[model samples]
Target: MGASFCSPVDERCTCSLQSTIHAFRFPLWAVKVSDFLEMLGPPRPHHRLQEEGLLHEWFPGMFVIFTSHQWLSSTHPDPQGQQMEVLQKALRGMIDGSLQVHEDLVARSDRMNLSNTIRQHIAEGFLFFDWFAIPQITVRKDGVNEESVKSAAALAVQSIPAYVELSNVFIALVPELTHKDSSALVNYASWLSRGWCRAELWCRLLSNKIDTTVIVIHSPTQAEFMFPLDWQHNSIVNGNFTVESDRAIVVQLGETAVESKIQHLQVHGPLRDCRFYCALRPKLLCQERADRTLQKFLEDFRFGSLEQAVKDTSGMNAVMCAILSGDTGMLRLLAESRADVSRPMHGLNDLGYYDTQTPLMAATKSHQDPAVLTTLVELRADPNGRASNTKLSSLYMCRSAGHVRALLEQRAELEHAALHGAAALAGPDTLRELLSRQCDPNHILAGRQERFGPLHAVALFSLSNRHAVEAAKLLLEHRADVNSRSSPSDEFLWECRKARMRVVVLGFANCNMMTRLRASMSGISPLGYAALVGHGQLTQLFLDYGADPTPNDRGDTPEDLARRNHHYHLIPMLATFAT
Candidate 1:
């Protein structure tokens, strides 16, 4: 509606909030950033700053004294440098406390990452586990091969140049990187990025392309993939063509190459399984729900219904479940009821699964009541039955120091069976004993990507920052492959990042860790990972071992990731190279 000389009262007046007008004007001093943005008057202060004697009365005007006690950075608030922190604190208070919604303005800004700025100050809130700080390998107590190991390690490290060319060779193949060598990769890319896009000249991640995939089925438990037939020859996300899935988000690279060499490849021409290891009809999809079925059986000594369980005497799983549960009465009843005490499990994809052993294998995984295990043994259950499908029998399940003395038993080597992947899941002590018994370290049982032996299994299992130190120690004493390319994904780095674990500072000739370094996508080794997540000592260790401060295709290196991830303590680590 228009009004010309009041022809018609303008309807525009009915709408509220014009900046030039005010029913009751107020000073801006009492207003908050939020209230001003809303274009609405704030609620009256409980007590005006002047009324509360909180402000100094100047000749004509007065103002509130912004004390540092109320705001840590009040005296030196660097708005540009600390905007993220300020916004995060304010947002948090608004969400959790008294601040009212600043709807119109709040919806416009993105400040989630700003919160990470403050988290940078805290320590130890984020470690997934503490086992990462410990060493993974150890020396054999018996000293059986000490001299041989020393000779091998010294020969390997001394033969290789200190500053090896990363682009030209498979560092993992060097004898210096053999099992006895003690070096590992440390990744810390997040700290290096510090949350900003890198300069273009340093090499931006233009894009990553993958148009090929190969699938292979392995029973009901797992599956495999091959990007190129020549796995040994390739490395990178889609690099030399073979590997299996680890977790959902692994940052893997096969090898390092400048932009030019990456463009040319021989396998651009050809391509290559089925059944979802699933509810997916394959073994993996809806696999055992949290190991609950096993957990329950181990706890209850019986299934949901004891009656149904008692009738199946030869059911190896039922016996094993009873033993794992350590229910002496249940075992007594089962054995008295004529259960086949000598039967073993049938699902031996490897020694880890469907292992044969009527109920003996069950007891191995369970630390149940000793009486139940003894009862099963007294009932003539085979201590050395042919296991599910492994190289050794059921006796090796008692690898624990306690279990070993209890059973005086048992063990495998099908390095590359279809169950080869599962074989990688074997226990460290169990494998160590087997290797001590002279099992071939490089034996390929069924289908294995890397023919390296038991040590690879130990290192891979320690990925979660759990059992890594002990696992590594056992492998080292036995001479596990330091540079061996294990399961192909870059998962080791992720676990390192999560825990900020530090690897040993073994010399470079022993840099079997180079493959692990190259396999990771971001410019981080496990040490870099630790630094980004705020582990200073880990950063030092990796630097000593020569963790390169190189960035990936994105020009975001370990130092960059650490800062961005709010691992402020690690920022100074890079200063060592700051000439």
Candidate 2:
């Protein structure tokens, strides 16, 4: 296949652990992967990374990355009182039993009692592997300190044979995973093919970066997603992750090297012709394509395309690498084999597809997957296929989603895709499945970039608010119009302030890492976008939820928009919630 693909896209071939006692056998050397996943910070009052607004998620581009500095932390060579007397003599060799239960105990207790304070001081801390919930199917029920899961299971039995040689090169290149969450999809390649949980409870959950995210079985047609591949599989619309091209990988059990793991493997299909695919990269053309072999190149094109009129200038053209990997089955096998399916194959230094599309508008990208937009509308592909939001099409992105009405009820015509909004971007099931097919959850979008209106489309937004308050209580039980029939009125927080600074600098933006509440800018509400952005306790949990101190005809109020935006670090908690 492309000359039997032999590694070497070189970030120094990913390995490093001069003293690997067990941080997952310390590898995947240059470690910096975050096309959005930076939440691991709270172990015991360790806050200062600019106090981490921290509510994060989305890694649907399923990943694997490795690197470790190991952690003897009290400054080594018997320093903090001889490393607390060698962790109190390894907790008397774990209370006189002699510690074994290996399989990479967080890479096998990197040289004992995992830095013991008699098992990290137990008020309810210790057990590991809790990155975004779903591994052996739910841990952290609070119970793992067997001397910190044994020193990361002797560094995960030397990092599970380097992820079984990188899941044998992504299970011989994406054959479509094989079938339904294939055992929670590779469960980190079945936690290193059934050796499961060692490196002492995977370093007591990656040394307290105790994060979350796992989709499984990453390659034979891609799926290995550690965290955030965009979730909400059934209710409240959007970010579905379309499984079933046999199985699509979600791989990442432990680690060894190759830049600590992640080789670009998403591959969706249908919702009018979904896209994504860049499997096995490293051809190196270099003009300043940012290079470490190009980081997340728009999630695997990494940094090499700001000009694609439908890529594949040379090799590996699985439907032009699946429309440069927006990949809805190689973009419907290259638009059912025609392949130009509206040609905007690359151009995203910051959005520029500029053209028409039919492959279900190239898989509906401000984030997609309701069974790959219902298999690109049963392969006819075009549930109102037009682009740049002329009025509204992708059925307002399947009306805030119920699995895109469980796949547009299996073959299109779910009343203009449930009344259009995927472009202005909002879906609690594509707008309550377009007001349950009557099409008027206050139906706005007269022309271009239409962001919000029904008194800012109701909610109890993301970080788990329960599906935009259950699709705004089913569009206020179908009466719809929360306001804005063409507002001279405009005061529901100014429409939440014109979408609230992209939701206070991209907040509820996750998938697979699973977060959903999104829409904003009417003002003074989401407690003035969390006190205009200081988040004082998520602006006191959005003023317990009433959120309206007044001053609209534009005089400015959530404490004068937090003192005219200086946010003097959240103006003494927005002047104690404006008295």
Candidate 3:
């Protein structure tokens, strides 16, 4: 079969070149919403504003709405004209109490009601729109006001975070429009990926508001209130378009917001939103999202129900939450309340989602505090619990040698597959600890088939990880078998032989010979894999440690494989020992 092609709509592989190129065109100046409502004549054209570099100031408590679109080039009545009608209706609903503001954000008591705050601002109807308000300079000209305009625009872009913070309400206007490629212009997935849209989104989320809700307008008639935490499932923040200073601002904003203990419980009934929020944004800037603050704070508080305590959007119960946040006290409370010790949390965040874990599994992976781990083990949580997707146990996710020892104290499985995962992910110290514990250094993942050993795992790890050499050195020092072969099953050999026969019958003998021969080979040693992937250092390391350069079941030596794969530099080194 032919290889499958990636479609433009495939989010994982394809990004819009048009959207990426135009992300820098942020509106520098905007007119007040009230000004737009009171305009008597056709307002001065964009050309005039571009020439003058003049703009009106936005007041505190003003409503700000951003649209992910360029100015209309057509003379026809624009579809965005309908957005004004929708905003007006929403405003009316907020004022009359017909529509509910975020239930969690609205005060339960008489003091500091967010609903009232929203109503007061809706009454003013003052808004900040980029196109109607911000001066748009299409091009630069030789004049005094030209530099002034550029400077003003620069300042406005720089102050976007502050602008979003000051605005009482934020709206994302994404109406469906036809693209030149026959695709919809205002898709939530597409709009969310744009650098400028993400910048606006982060500005609002990281703003000082304790309970921020973004209004997303999908069409002229429909709109929805989106939880800011929902966007954390992906990279919703723009890393580019803005400068390093701006990126730093976003990081600080996330840190500060996380510290406030995200108020998601008030917005959504169950702690699911909060659970999802915490899971997605834990402990890294660009690599992950943020830290765990909200879950840690709940230790001092009481929940109304077990459902509230148990229901996590990402499948984490209060027990797992406590363990993940390193809150020993919270863990004790949940355990005492008869919370299921073996409950699996399916993390929805970008980091830990694939590896759904039991409370024990979460603690084991975090390698945070031994007290937290000891408490879970005392509570009878399973140390050998596996994630639903990855099928990896707690012992496989140990962060360091100390963590491995701690899990070992709790009686974690010390088998070959488990050791393989540990060697692949952990540093040299962790590997040494496992080896010292009498865990076989040359152990293979499978029994009869002999899938892979420590050196093979080390070879794969070296491709991406910086400490591959050190890890290899550690395994070598532990006397891991350098030339241990990973044997394939008889079933695989039969399938390969059959496929090779078919290829030869079809008159493509040479084309499929090498591929089928490699496939038919019963086993490959550490040096074989090293030569296959073209890691010269790792191959040399194996050779220095006395690896066998002998051929496998298919009569192909390490040198022959490297030469076949066009690794000319490795041929000389392999030739040093190859007969």
Query: Which candidate gets the maximum lDDT versus the true structure?
Result: 3
lDDT of 1 at 287: 20
Quote the positional error of residue 25 for candidate 1 in Å. Answer: 46
Q: Which portions of model 3 miss their true places by more than 4 Å?
A: 1-282, 285-306, 311-314, 345-357, 386-392, 413-417, 447-450, 490-521, 559-571, 575-579
Rate residue 538 of model 1 by lDDT: 42
lDDT of each candidate versus the true structure: 0.31, 0.31, 0.53
Candidate 2 yields a Cα-based lDDT of 0.31
Ranking of predictions according to lDDT? 3, 2, 1
The deviation in Å at residue 102 for candidate 3 is 42
TM-score, each model?
0.31, 0.26, 0.50
- lDDT per residue for candidate 1 within 397-447, as digits (tens), equals 443434443444322222223111222333455555555555554443323
307 Cα displacement, candidate 1 (Å): 6.9
Model 2 residue 398 distance off true place after TM-score fit, in angstroms: 14
Q: With candidate 1 superimposed using the best TM-score fit, by how many Å does residue 213's alpha carbon deviate from the native?
A: 32
Tens digits of per-residue lDDT, candidate 3, 1-579, equal 000011112221111111111123344355444445544433443445445543444533334443333222233113335435444554555555543332111011111112444455455544555544443354334453876766756655555655555554566654433343333333343456545566566656544343345665533223345433234433434434324455565556445444333553444434554553453345323343223344544542234455567543345556655665566766666667677777666543322333356677566555555666777877888777777754667777775777777777888777656567666656777777777788887777664242678787776444333356677888788788887876655565575566446545653222222333334344667788667545667788889999889676666688876665434447887998744
